[model samples]
Target: MKSKVKPLPAEQKEEIATSEPLPAYASEEGIDPELLETARVRLELLYGEVAADWPGFIARPGQYQMMQAALLTFLSAKAPEDADRSGRQLAQLEAGTGTGKTVAYCLAAIVASEILKKPVVVSTATVALQEQLFQKDLPRLAKIIPDLRFDILKGRARYVCQSRLEGVINDVAQDMLPGDMFQDAFIDTRRQQEVIPRDRGQAMRWFKSTEKKLNNGSWDGDVDSLAQTPDPQDWRQVQANAHACNGGRCEFFKSCAFFKARRQAAGATLQVANHALILATLQNESTLIDAGNTLFVFDEAHHLPSIAAEQFSYRARIGTSSKLLTSLRTVALRHGKTLPASTRPDPVAFAQLITGCTDKLSVLERFWIDAGLVSAEKDVHRFTQGEIPQDLIPECEELANLLGSVNRTVERIAEALMEQDESLSVSERDEQTRAGVELGVYVSRLGTLEKLMRSWATHDKIPWAKWLEWVEDAGGTNIDAWLCASPMTAAQVLSKNLWKTVSAAVCTSATLTACGSFDFFDRMSGMNRFPERRSLVVDSPFDYATQGELRIAPMKHSPKNSEFSGELCLKLPGLLLAHEHGQLVLFTSRKQMQACHAALPAALEKQVLMQGVLSRVELLKEHSRRVKQGERSIIFGLQSFGEGIDLPGELCEHVVIDKLPFTPPNSPVEEALSEWLGTQGRDPFLELSVPRTGMKLAQWAGRGVRTVTDRAVITICDTRLISMRYGQALLDGMPPFPVVRPRA
Candidate 1:
């Protein structure tokens, strides 16, 4: 069945092009003009109150106007006859960093919700902004608008499974009984380590007494947060033993934390969630959040396309057999028993199973990769709608069989482990049985993996690519190249499920427009064609001219070879040597990062906080501390350092980008996807790569100016941005800063 919705008609485009204003809805009959004016005054008053109440809540000069425009557009839709018009409304407002976008969006949502009496869903790209909205922004707004209720909606994994926890606790208790004497030595050793170093016996006694505290659902069922709990290993043991909760069917369903959280959200006026969960809900996984009549505010909307892509992508590795074998062997040793010499798990048999599966996976991966790459390399167009190559049919059949065989082998291995348990001592048998259980888990995981592989490889609508990577470990033999596949672009997956189905959506981002155009964001985000949609660009209210300086460095080397790194390494020192040192030196690649760090003088080495050496938070803290102490310091980092960093005043003075960050075309996955696109007759570079790179470079450059008071010199070492045609688009998307070009 075709989608009922079509792209915005030509006439509608002309209407928008002509800059025709939306009709005034306040005069419409049966409409409460006084009430509408009260709502408008409330919104304006709320903004004023926020600015007055918070020290940092300053609205830029044009911000009030943008907010009013958005409100008017929303109000126009609520008018009696306007509701039946069946068209999406769009408002583009560029509220700069300090302009309090959260408050503005909150006001918009509140006003609309009160008028329309429907929930508003706000989606953000990063966790930081999501937290800000929930923790700081929404709470403050809620105090002002007492009638409005809000809830944070995260992914299913965020909440703890009460039934799963109970099952785990029961399993651990049952296993501790006298009959189940066998225990893996590694598990025992791990338990022992939990005891205090000096008083092991006392620690064990204390642990036994406090074990009940672990079962109270305090851990939140989030594995990451569980680490901070006392007796983390024991907590993990409980988690591992926990059964797969079947929602309502499970015994502890009523008290399930996840369910409770969801129930609470049902009555909320505003729902806050990450982009992934939002898409998942739209895909029909759950109906907890209503999409229709909901207004979605996507913060950091730039990363939506990639995030959507990852959600719909799938990958399977072939070297899992080797890892499984090693885990089985460890289980056997820890259980105080060995596999019978005559019938030991045959490595050759495992190798055969892996090779067979890999051969099939390789075919699917290669086909898609070649199709994407060939489409790109050959400059093919209109490749989205096409059939899989006929030659790949045989390979697909082989892959199906290979996946079946692998699944069967994993099951057999698990069964063998279970059978061998009878011959061991009680303790040994228990450990062996647990090993069997572990094998069974792996077997089940493999089954799901196979199903995912089959679904992606054979699915008609989703474009897929297969690629391989080799991994090595210190104590292990060289692993075979692992094969995997994923969708060519997530937009294709989302377009089929969420975007096409949604009645209306307003996709807004600060950086949506390129040179006053929404073309880049629309195309990359897969929302380029929607007949019911409207587009707007609201300029950021930040004073860029006074807040930042953009400098184009005179480059002596091209970005193609090793010489570029050497030249950058030599030249970067000169920029840092004299500066009062809070500098963020961002490189496009690891090679350049390393070269720059290595070439620095010994004195400056102590001052250089390089990426990969420490976590981002750690590096930032150290840099902040040193910069505050009046010591010169330079932070050398890659992509993650580009944005989401807020350092004002002297804590950061210069932001240096070694080159325009672009995706490397040589990646196996990219090459394969490009080839797959090519086979389908698409221009992979323009459709997939270039626009993606353009977005990244823009984000990278955005780090230079954070707050209105923050002033820094942004040095772009890559001359290509100045010389290349596409470079203007990247520059134009950035804040309106004065550019300084060095004389040749």
Candidate 2:
């Protein structure tokens, strides 16, 4: 196979080559022509108003083109009544930085949702972007359309649970009975140990202050909304969680903070969420949003595949799980004693079930140890092609059945404890509620182990990666073995779950294409399965030829050489000193960043700020403060600082990338994916690494030029940009910056 290097698209095309004509049903029936015409008129009016009246608005052709393309793709969607019809209602939109992509998609999705009579759900990959949409972009659009309403819905763990908070404030300050075995068992079974504040007086005061704020409506019960960041351990004790939630049965359900937000989300025209929450809803973990009747706009859509894969994977520990079962059994017996005779769970029967599970688990652990599957020398043992030893299947099946039975018995015990008993004292009621929540947590853990065991017991058509990892203590001593399994790819999963059922969707990102094509994203995101899916790439309006230049620093060693860090340190100082303002030095690895930082001169080191020393937000703030004070500042960061950092004008006048971000197949899932691809006679490096590296390079280079008048320079320390054959392909994926090469 030959390498094909496609140059960056210079302008937007009228029609995407891959987009097919709308299906006959969408064109001839089930759509109201009057409604579409009204929507089009409203969209045009809004765009015109923004162009004329909005402050700091630039007249960019790319934004308009993107808006038109997005609107058309959405208009081609099949209505809810025609969901089973043969039509794909997805638009793969890639808008470059500074293209106003968020506003473009929001307007399009909102209008289409009105016409289709479905709610719009926009999912982002990061909280910052989600905040920008809800707090910044949508508010501006809402002014244009007065009726526009949107709400942000995060995971349940973000809010405070009033019930838990009251219990913590009331009970934690008092003494407990001395010889209470049930109490000891509940404490042991908890995943998070109780946190004892160092200053109990100050802690109690803070808790009272927070409770008062919740009562006075000054605080919304969201940790993020707090003026001061609460201690994470303290927050975990009172945070809203699935295990602790009794839903409508709770005394505070009417005013529950998480439920209040969910109720608002149900009524809002648009709901903003993150990728993990959306995938969690698909997995039936929670029902926060209705996927079937919702139109979605996924921003930063490139992250969907990895997030989906992680959401579906399962893991369990052998030793820890055995101990947890024993503790759960004890808690179950104690709680059974508290319930009435008629409603009480059968403690003897439940104990027998748990004992069977523990017995099978012990046998499995012995099999792993005796069969030499896990040892001190090896930390990870992955099954080839996801196939485990034939002898282990029967044991897995037996354990799965026993665990399932035990899991059901635990659920029954939890429900029995949930029943309200009028005769119980206040302390007894509190203990019962707390015990039920712990049992709920155990039920969840047992369900996870059962799923992993079932996956091991039976084979599926889709490929999976099964592995055993030896868990070690901080002193490097082996403590337990972990069983893990994950699918090779999430493309098929997304296609079956989302694309086939969703009413309509648009996946947009700044760096979706690799090597000037959407083939990689299409395959990885499961969009390729829908041949009728439309795609459009809108170039940034900024004139990169004048605004920025790319310089390939001359190097004597390749990035793979041991001396490359030395080479990078030598080249970066002059570049940093010349800018004398905001400078970002991105490294692919922490080891390299440390090496380069240590080698810098004393004066330069004083001016440098490295990641992990301060939080990302504070680091950026400190750098900005120095730059605003007319002082030189250089930031040393890794992959996390590559894409989301926004420093325009004098804040960031130069960006120095140590080398290409080439991530090889290191994890079990990636290795299994590469192995599967290789068996089909494909080159994993070209298909996976190159394209992914291309996207990273594009994102890194984009940080250089943010606004129209802002000028900056991007310097690449690695020689591969000009020395390797595939380097040109990576270059073609980046902005059309003027290239400066070293003289021969």
Quick one: best TM-score, which candidate? 2
The C-alpha stretches of model 1 lying farther than 4 A from their native spots are: 1-42, 65-95, 170-243, 317-462, 467-483, 514-516, 666-669, 676-689
Tens digit of lDDT per residue, candidate 1, span 602-668? 9888899998899888989999999889998788988888777877778778888998776756644
Report the lDDT tens digits of candidate 2 across residue range 1-744. Answer: 423221113243223222358432123233457876787777766666666555677656667667766776666665546645343477788898889887788877777877778788899997767877888888887776788888998988889988878866886412211112322222222334444445767766778898999989999998888998787556756788786577787778998999898888778899999998888787863556666678888999989888988878888877667777787777677777877788676777878888888887898788778878777787788888888888888988998998998888778778878777668987777677766765676666677889898888776665688888776544864377888888777888788777776777888899989988899998887888887677878868899989989998878889899888787878777778888888899999999899888988899999999999999889999999999999988999998888988999888899999998999898888998898789889999989999999999999988888889889999998889889988999999999899999777
lDDT of each: 0.59, 0.79
Could you tell me which residue pairs clash in candidate 2? none
Q: Give the TM-score of candidate 1.
A: 0.71
What's each prediction's TM-score?
Answer: 0.71, 0.89
Candidate 2 residue spans exceeding 4 A from truth: 1-34, 78-87, 172-209, 338-343, 371-377, 421-434, 474-478, 578-580
